[model samples]
Target: MTENATGGEVTFADMRLRPELLDVLSALGYEEPTPIQKEAIPPLTEGRDLLGQAATGTGKTAAFALPVLERLTPQGDGAGPVALVLVPTRELAIQVSEAFHRYGRILGARVLPMYGGAPFGRQLQAIKRGVDVVVATPGRALDHIGRGTLDLEGLRTVVLDEADEMLDMGFADDIEAILAATPATRQTVLFSATLPPRIDGIARRHLSDPVRIEMGHTAGEGRETTPLVEQSAYLVARAHKPAALGRLLDIEAPTAAIIFCRTRDEVDQLTETMNGRGHRAEALHGGMEQEQRDRVMSRLRAGTADLLIATDVAARGLDIEQLTHVVNYNVPSAPESYVHRIGRVGRAGREGVALTLVEPREHRMLKAIERVTRQRIPVERLPTVADLQARRMELTRAALEECLLQDDLESFHAVVESLTDEFDLMEVALAAVKLAHESSGATPDEEEIPEVAPRAVDKRRGPRESAHDGERYQRGPGGGMTRLFFSVGRSAGIRPQDLVGAIAGESSLSGRDIGAIEIADRFSLVEVPQAAADEVIAALRQATIKGRRPTVRRERDTRGRRPR
Candidate 1:
């Protein structure tokens, strides 16, 4: 292993990777190993179980991927797959699979990324032909296992990437089942951004004699670590978030930005709204096909698209070099999630901005995140119409300056000279500037977003608590919650996670926003925010639950009348 005399910097060459992998790393311009990578590769290459805690953009992918490639067996050994990597989302599965392919190019590694929403026949054929590595989502991995298409007896290594995210997506049971199918002697490695108690329980149960490593934002920086991200929030009412976001984007004028939303519907809605406002915006969510997603990403990377409005799951594992801003459309459900979202930007020593739109009710949630992250996120006033006009004038002035310096204006000098003869020189210049400003597609925002103050609450009461009490009558953070009835329940093998995932996947309500759920023998009742009740009902009516469309409706009283 090669290291500098100071013993602080270690090159990828020092990691003892094979010649092929080293050459690929060099070609990719990777000089040294990240903190997580440096500490993990050694133990992992030695076949020891590992539990690593590092946030996004910390190079954890290379840490696990390089080791997996280093230990790959030769092809045509009749071994289905020597390595199995389970991720939370299909995007991450594809990303990790591509990394393995890139690093293992010289080894002729047969790597496959298996996930839902792709052609099943192709994945099945790939497995039948034989693969050295399989990177897959937990649910799809379980599907193949049940179909007898994926055999784990020959597996030598099992990696759970983004382990906490999988659990949050209701894949814990599926992960446990897949792990149970793998060989007990196989090397197990789990990586998560946070070490919650549930994560610890999984580590205790799955990893044996593991090497534990924990490093977050301050990894290798010690107490002097400083975040490069400028975090701020805007206190706008729920109804004005779209306008506020549009105004903020106009003033900020970022090179590129990723706006995170909670659900697929929200992503689509915001994408359309932003596009109408003259921004080249794109939507990415679970509903999009693989091909469509590839097109969106290509457009963004090629500089044709400026805004990527995406759901949390679909946007996982994406790192864009030119990203300058990260906007939270709503307060994140969890504080750890806030950390992960902001981590996407402010990387590689580049300054980045993190902006958020906070509704009155979500102020408390935002405060909780601040307390957890130990960072103060000052709420800023939304930009007014006057601010927008000034920003547009500035942009027009800069554009005109660039044109005068670079463009061939000699051709238009004759027209200007002729006009100057009939008009004052200053008047002609003002006319020219006005035409330039108008042609630049600068539309002034008229209405001002109403500002809302945070609700003052008694010290004893919670922010979300309503006047009513009892588990049966609980409300969401916003207001009262309404219970909806589904025809299928325990008999159809329905679980809470299944319902949570279904609602969260289809509607604007997140899993955290959902209230108590009761599953009976033949029916189920789930509580959603009262304001979102109709939307949830409409979405569920259109979606299938457990492969069957269940009759959905607002629960009624014993008299068969709707509850008031």
Candidate 2:
């Protein structure tokens, strides 16, 4: 169903939202409703069951969330959980819960997120106090139900988000059980990227005659061409990829992009490597907590993060309008996955670019992708010094053009006038332009990004230790000193680099500030500058490394003997 034109003005004013919510959104600068929100909000507000098919990053969360907020009653005397949202992953559960909290804060609406990995006592406590909304993953929600800690008897609305992913992850039975427990008369909404048969069965079984809204496709038209996507690929040795990718990014300089990798470990390593090369990069994978993922996405959306290295599963359903590029760090196993990866860009009639880094052996897979998509992905060569220079010049010219278009140049005229009197007008103009361009790294003669060996195929925890050896070494604490720990020597998977990275990324401490890290299976010790110990512990408390929270704190002395 299309959005009714009548509600346009009201729909646009998320500011008219409850005062607290308006403050949050306004502070966050969310000024407009995405297309999904425009179409889904009205019907949902009317209490109609809905089946919405939309891509990731289309603001689907706000689409369903706004209506949920509008319909929810305050928690003052409710026995509920008035609204229940079931997501596939713990990360999504937290994200949706946070959204509900943000939107309903002014209304005094209470929302709780329940998921695995977190201690159950916190969830139980929150439930006992009463919640207007519960955002949960299927497995943990079902656990709560079986334990009698969660009651859905008062639930008014039930939402199944990313239903297909849940099904894919083997949670279909759990989903069915959860839906069965909810009241039969409740308003049911299911949102998925695709309507596979499994999803169709779920809809038929649960939803009363629903209004279906499928965005991105016209009634009679065939699949629309991704005219905005400028598809290209490069052949490089596996060892040369990092350097090649860095160079490509340097030349293209996408406003935002997600570099898709095959594994979580790869995501972390690539993110660190990219950051070292001076790109504002972040990593997203299942290994991170919901809060961390949210922060990473926030950074990406806010332009604080220019490159996001992530696994496909972690990046699923991510829609970032500012994303102008999609890079395949490794060839995807299937062509459909490739399509989904690149589709993240070239959306909503905006131009986008997709680049795939293909190893020699993956040429056949590339050909297979071409066969399935019915489009030829042109092979491109690595950028040479000349090409890099030309690209920088183009960027400089673009910046100058933009500056000329703006109205804030009156104060700068004096500087230009004084310089013009002292030198030839053309030379002065060029010099001033050169200074501005150089400040932005738009200099044609800027040093080339170093060519590291292509990333080696190692099953180890870090990059290759030697220039020629494929054996990767974990990153050590940067400073010569090491922090002593009392907890290590037994159970934790704590490693030297793990301690260093966790401290450096999560805390205010720089890589140079961290000294040395020593890890044992049960407990581990790290070395950081004494001055930054408190900050390091505080940061570690919030960081999730290797799927578990690090118990980082100052080491208490057990014996009189201390190592010098």
Best by TM-score: 1
lDDT of 1 by residue, 1-564 (tens): 335557845767777888889878766545457667888998999999999876544568889989888887668357589899987656567778998898887898999998755666999899888899999877667778977999888898999887766666567777888889999999999988667899999999989999998754332222222389999998887778899999999999999999988657678788999999899999997667899999999999999999999877678899999999999998765465577788889888888999988875466557656656778899987888898999999999999999999979999999999999999999999999999999988885368777666532222122331223221312234348778888887778776666665675455555556777667767777888788888878766645555567887888772376673
Tens digits of per-residue lDDT for model 2 on 130-237? 888899877667778977999899888999997765654446666788888999889999998668788899989899889898754433221343867999988776
Q: How many residue pairs clash in model 2? A: 17
Candidate 1, lDDT over the whole model: 0.78
Give candidate 1's TM-score. 0.57
Q: What lDDT score goes with residue 346 in model 1?
A: 83
